[model samples]
Target chain A: MRIVVLAGGIGGARFLRGLRQAAPDADITVIGNTGDDIHLFGLKVCPDLDTVMYTLGGGINEEQGWGRADETFHLKEELAAYGVGPEWFGLGDRDFATHIVRTQMITAGFPLSAVTEALCDRWKPGVRLLPMTDDRVETHVAVELGGERKVVHFQEYWVRLRASVPAEAVVPVGAEQAKPAPGVLEALAEADVILFPPSNPVVSVGTILAVPGIREAIADAGVPVVGLSPIVGDAPVRGMADKVLAAVGVESTATAVAEHYGSGLLDGWLVDTVDTDSVTRVKAAGILCRAVPLMMTDLDATAQMAREALTLAEEVRQA
Target chain B: MRIVVLAGGIGGARFLRGLRQAAPDADITVIGNTGDDIHLFGLKVCPDLDTVMYTLGGGINEEQGWGRADETFHLKEELAAYGVGPEWFGLGDRDFATHIVRTQMITAGFPLSAVTEALCDRWKPGVRLLPMTDDRVETHVAVELGGERKVVHFQEYWVRLRASVPAEAVVPVGAEQAKPAPGVLEALAEADVILFPPSNPVVSVGTILAVPGIREAIADAGVPVVGLSPIVGDAPVRGMADKVLAAVGVESTATAVAEHYGSGLLDGWLVDTVDTDSVTRVKAAGILCRAVPLMMTDLDATAQMAREALTLAEEVRQA
Candidate 1:
């Protein structure tokens, strides 16, 4: 089976691990969000991309669900000691090897997508991983701080501020002009099923869809396109999905998120069993909706969610 | 008093430490060689400049005579793990900080000389440290490996090969076209006395003089210019200085080194007491020569050598 997954960070990585378990022989192509990419201490850091790579490649910090396992922060600590900062974003020593290789390749003039492919050669992530766009796309949050409105990088808003203040606007700075990286459209065209992991609809998957032609491609792919809810019972399963969702004036409810993505690009939606009441409302908004136990408590539990999403894809395609 | 010193790695750093103690009130400016500077993992590694800074600043590994004390190789280990190398070069985690700061500042468009000044701000290495040139000048040594004559980076020859083979030629790649860094000529022009520490005659002091106007500046400055012999009893006091000197056709002897710098550029030369027999030979070459106890056993022993150099400067100034 040829499956294309549009992914974000920790949650997406966990879901992919589940998907790999559920479909071991499947040919998976991942389109990773680069909106969270930031340059720290002069090294390029793609949090979402690295999270997926590490998790899928068996190097992930299982407890945190991001970064490398057995990682040390001595590199980051040294950077801090030099007073070179954004000390808030943790980059461990083992994880830093990823960024160093990546930055070295990028600085040598290879496009980021090419660099991603080259790095994947080492990780053997069991999937062809490509960045959403080689061009830079930083998600900025327009927020009110100390009664003054300011725009901060997504990481600053998320990691530094912990999204404490309401984000007045969630902006994907370079999306409109970005072209889908090579193989993206072809993968979409060849995909049998496309899944959006329970990643943040506002900044993770939404920021990617904000890129021109990508959303159009998925909408036109004629494949079963299904998404699992990042929000369950009016709360994000992981991360600060609500704060940025609120930036776009979307409510934290699962139904509202389905309405935000709308029926144009989505074939089906999966909400958690805890939000069973919202299934009918989400279906009423035109997405073929189902309620599944969505808590990724373990490998088997997460694999069950992946299996359920694929089952929904089958039902939507048959209908 | 104003003092200008030409320096290389460990020996120069140790001598500078002694010079600091010997003339506590004197204003000292160190012209550090950059031919040994290299780009490893896309970060600039300035060995000579950093060694001087670290040794004088109390950050140097005492026994190893380079790198940082209490250093970890996690960063280097991680780099090796990625298979991105020159695995031969040892860059410890703490020392990586200096490069990160330097590369960051240089990438932000600061010249190497300015970057050195900023780094010195952190180290507070007593002497004003200046790179020989802001422009890149890598020392490449021509050698025969498996009957193939090829030029390799000096680090490759010294670190990887361990200088085990004969170096056919020693070339400073960028020195011919290089301009002395800002304040280099000014430092030379305003100097009351200049000393060449027991540094590599080929790569260190020689590379510094290779910059366009510096050798002329020293020659025309007309102040007493004294040099301490790097060789003790026909061998370098430390390091593989002898190996590179042979590549340049200079015999590895204290008298030959004095003759290599020659009477035009050197007014006084200090050899170790063991090379006392060669003092007349150096004097016959028209440079005033002294045989002093040159082993830098400790700070006090090194300070005495520094004092001897100053005393020689006074004698030469009178003559």
Candidate 2:
């Protein structure tokens, strides 16, 4: 089976790890969102890409789910001593080299997709990882801080502020003109199954769909497009997904999240066992629905969720 | 008395530390050469300036006489993992952040001198350190490599190649048109006495003199300018100073080095105790000379050298 998974950061990385375990013989292609990318300390940092690469490459700090394991902060301390500190975000010494290489390649006129591909050469994360777009699409959040409305970069809102303030609006700048990376649309067209991992729907899958041809490609592919719910018991699995979802007027409910992705893109939807009652409502929204254990506790648990998602896709195709 | 010191790295940093102990009240100003500065991993690195700053700030690695104490190299390892191994020169994790901040500031339109000042704000070296120029002035070494004449950056020749290949020519690119940093001329004009630290006479002090008005300012200063010998018993205090001097067609001897600077700028000179017989020969070159124990073994020994240079300046003034 040729499975193509759309991913964000931590949630996406964890899900992919399980996806591999569930379908060991299948070739997996990952379409990672680069909307949260930020240029920091004079280097380009793609948080989602690094998370996926490090997690799959076996270099991730498993407990933190981001950055390289066994990292040091000597560079950050030195930057601080020079008073060049953006102190809120922790950029470890080992992690910084990733940003430096990506930034250098980008400055040398290579697109983000090409840079991501080159970086993956070192990690060789079993699955083929492709950035959703080559264009400069940055995720920004509108927040009122110090009694002033300002749009800060995604990292500032996510890492620095820890998403304390309500996101008035979340904008993926330059998404409108961003063309899908070369292999992205092709993967969607030829994919046996398209799985939307429990990543941020508004920022992850939504950003991938925002790229010009990607959404159309999946819609026209005539294959099962299934999405797993990130919300369980009216709360996000990880990160500040609810805060960002709320910025776009989406409620923190599995049913609402399914409705947000809507019938246009998703043919099947999988919600957590706790949200089984909402399956009827999700199916009523013209989407095939199934209730399953969606919390990825471990590799086995994650594989079970992946199996459930594939089973749900098969049922939707039959229906 | 006001004192001016021409310096390089390591030994220069250590000697400067002792000079501070010897003349705690003198307004010390350092005219650092920028020829050895190199851009690595997209960050500008001024090894000489950093040496002086870290040495005086009490953050220098005492054994290495360079880089930060308690430094980690997670960044370098990561960079190497990304296939960015500039394997020749060692760049510690702590040291990289300084370069990042410097590159950021320089790219933001601040001159090198102003950047040095801003960096010194945290270091508080208690002395002014100025680069020879704000403009780019790199030293290039022409050598026969792979049976073809090619020029490589100074760092590559010095650190990477270890100067094993004989340099056909040594050129200070852009030095003819480069201007001395602000306060350079003023420091020389107001100086009651000046002493050259035991740095590479050709690369360190020679590069400073290569700047348009710096050499003229020292000669025009109505004060005694004394220099300590870096060459003791026909060998450098440290590093490949002898090889670099040979490339520049200068002999590796205290008398020869003193004569290379000449009486045009220097009013007095200090040779190591082992080279006491060369004192008369240096004096014959039309500069006042003194035989002194110039080895900077410790703070006491270095302070003694500084005191000797200062006393020599006084004798030349009174004579």
Candidate 3:
């Protein structure tokens, strides 16, 4: 089977690891959200892409579910000492090598897709990883801080501010102009099943979908388009998904999230057993819905969740 | 007294430490050589300027005479793992921070002089450090590599090749078109005494002089221009100075080095006690010459050498 996954950072990366284990024989192509990419210390940092790459390649900090394992923050500390930073973003020494290489290649006129491919050449992440769009598409959040409204990059909103203030709006700044990276539309078109792992819908998977051609391609792909809820029991499984979901006026519930993606793009939706009650509401909205174990507690449990999603996809295809 | 010093990397940095100790209250301005600067991994690596800053800031590796004292090469190792490198040059984590800051600032349209000043805010290296030129003035060494005469970067020749082959020519690639950095000529004009540290005569001090207006500024400054010879006992005290000195057709000897500068530019010259017999030969060339214990074995010994240079400067002023 050829599976295409739209991934964010930690949660999506962790889920992809499970997906890899569950469908060992399947060819996986990951369309990583680059909206969270930030240039820190003049180097390009693709948080979501690096997470997926490192997680699958065994270089990830398993505990944090992002960044390189055994990493040192000496470079970050030194940068801070020089008063050059967004000291809030923790870019470790080992992790910095990735950005440096990516930035160097990008400056040398290689597109981000080509650079991603070159970087993956080292990780051999098993799956081909393509950035959603090579063009700059930063997710910015409009928030009221100190009684003033301001738009901040997704990273500053998420990593620095910790999403403390209410998000008034969440905008994928350059998505309207960005074309899907070279292989993205083809992968979706060729996919047997398209999965949205339990990543943030508003700024992660949502931003990738916001790219001009990507959402249209997936909707037209003729594959079983399925999604696993990031929300369970009216709360996020991980991360502050509810906060940004509120910005888009989506309720922090599995059924609400499924309805937000809507029946047009989603063929199947998976809610956790904890939110089993929401399955009927989601199915009533014209998309097939199933309640399964959605928490990625460990590799095996996560793999079982992946298997459940695949089974749900088969049910949607048959129906 | 206001003192101006022309400096290179390790040797120049070590000599500055002694000069600082010798004239504790003297106002020192260092015109640092930038020809050895190179871009590696898409970051500007200013070896000589950094050496001076780190050495004076108490961050230098005492044994190696360059880089940070407690440096780690994790970033470098990771870069190598990604197969991105000219692996020979060792840029530690701490050192990489400096280059990253510099590269970022430069890209943001700050000249190297402004970047250097901003960097010094953290190092507090006491002396005002200025690059010889703000314009890119790279030193290229022409050598026979694999039996083909080719020109390579100064860092490639010195660090990578270790100056293994004879240097056929040492050219400061952009010197003719390059103007002295802001305050370089002013520093020379205002100098009470100008001292040339025992840095490489060919690439270090010579390259600085190659900047269009700097040599003229120093000669016209009318202040005592005294130089401590890098060569002692018909050989360089440290580094492979002889290989490059030969490229310029100057013999690697204390007396010969003084003659190479000539009386028009050099007011006084200091050679080691071993080269005492050749003091008259240097004097015959119309520049005042002295023989002193020039070995910088320790701080106190190096300080004595700085004091001797200052004393010689006073004698030249009287003459």
Candidate 4:
């Protein structure tokens, strides 16, 4: 079976790790969200892509579930000493290497997609990883600061601001004009099943879909497109998903998130057992819904969730 | 007293340290050689100017004579792991900060001179340090390599090859079209003594003079123009000065180096005591000459040499 996953950063990476184990024989392709990419110290840093690559390639700091394992922040410390900083974003020494090679290749005229391929050559990530789009598609968040309206980069909004302020608007600035990266549409067309891992609905999977052709391709791919809820009960499983969900005027609940992606693009939705109450509302919205244990407490626990999503996909296909 | 010094990397930086000690009351202006500047990994690295700044700023790795003290190479090691290299040049994590800040500023449209000043604001190196030109002026050395004649960067010749091969020609690629940086001519025109530190004459002092108006300004300044010979006892006191000097058809000897600079530009020449015999030869060429203990074994010794150079300058002025 060929599986495609639309992924964000840490949460999505963890889910994909379990999916790989749950369906070992399945060929996996990940269309990573690049809207979180930022230029730091003149180097193009694709945090989401790196998280997926490092998580799969055995370089990730297992404790943190992102960044390199034995990473040092001497580079970051030095940059701050020079008074060059957004000091909030934690880019370690090993991580800086990825950006350096990536920036070097990009400057040498390699597209971001091509650069991602070159980087994967080193990581040997089991899944074929492709960025959502090669063209710049920065996610900018509009907020009111100091009693005045202001706009900030996605990273500044997320990492720097901790997404504290109610986001007035969240825009994928260049997504409307972006074409799907070379392999993205083909992966969708060839996929036996498509999964959205429990990542940020607004900034991660949603931002990837915002690219002009991606949403259309996934909607018409004719495969069982399923999604797992990032929300459980009244809050996010990890990260500040509620802060951004609220920006799009969506309630912070599993059923609301499934309805947010909507029945047109989603065939199956998985909510945590704790939010079993949300299953009815989701199913009533014209989508097949299941309640499962969604906390990725361990690989076994995550793999069980993956198995459940795949089972739901089969059920939706049978229907 | 107002003093102007022409300098390169290690030797010149050490000399300036001594000059600062010898004349603490003097307002020193340093016209630093930029011919050795190279863009590696897409960042502008002015190695010589950095040497002067770091050395004077008390951050230099005293044991190595350059780079940040107690530096880490995590960024470099990671870059190599990604197979991004020129692994020959050891730029530490602390040092990478300087390049990153400089590259960022230059990308943001600041000239090299202004950037240097801004960087100095943190270092507080006391003297005014200026590059020979804000424009690019890379030194290229012609050599026979791989059974073909090729011109490699001066750093590649010196740092990579250690100047083991014979040099065919030495050229400062952009010096002909380059104008002296701001305050360079003004520094020279002011009624003061000008001193050439014992840096590589061919690549350091020679490259600085290659900028059109500088050599002419120093020759016409009429205030005593004195130089301490980098060559002593028919050999360079430090570095592979002989290899490049041969390319310019000058021998590596105290007297020969003075003759190469010539009486037109040089008013006084100081050679090591071992090269006392060359003093008469330098004087025979119509320049005043002296023999002094030139070994910079410690700070006091180096300060004494700086005092000797100033004394010789005064002697020539009296003559």
Q: Using lDDT as the measure, which candidate wins? A: 3
User: What lDDT would candidate 1 get against the real structure?
Assistant: 0.92
Itemize residue pairs with steric clashes in candidate 1: A72-A93
Q: Give lDDT tens digits, candidate 4, residues A1-319.
A: 9999999999999999999999999999999999999999899999999999999988999998778998888878878876778899998877878887898899899999999998888888899999999999999999999999999999999889998898999999999999999999999999999999999999999999999888999998999999999998879999999999999999999999999999999999999999999889999999999999999999999999999999999999999
A182-237 in candidate 3: lDDT tens per residue? 99999999999999999999999999999998999999999999999999999998
CAPRI-style grade of the A/B interface in model 2: high
Which candidate, 3 or 4, would have the higher DockQ against the true structure?
3
Output DockQ, candidate 2.
0.83
Q: Record all residue pairs in model 3 with backbone atoms less than 3 Å apart, i.e. clashing.
A: none
The best candidate in terms of TM-score: 3
Query: Which of candidates 1 and 4 is the stronger one according to DockQ?
Result: 4
TM-score of chain B of each: 0.99, 0.97, 0.99, 0.99
Which lDDT values do the candidates have, in the order given?
0.92, 0.89, 0.94, 0.93
What lDDT is reached at residue B202 by model 2?
71
Give the CA lDDT, 0 to 100, for residue B179 in model 2.
90
TM-score for each candidate, following the candidate numbering? 0.97, 0.97, 0.99, 0.98
User: What tens-digit string does per-residue lDDT give for candidate 1 at B1-319?
Assistant: 9999999999999999999999999999999999999998999999989999999999899999999888888878767766788788999877887888899999999999999998888789999999999998999999999999999999899889999999999999999999999999999999999999999999899989888999999999989999999999999999998999998899999999999999999999999999999999999999999999999999999999999999999999999
Candidate 4 or 3, higher TM-score:
3
Question: What's the alpha carbon RMSD for model 4?
Answer: 1.4
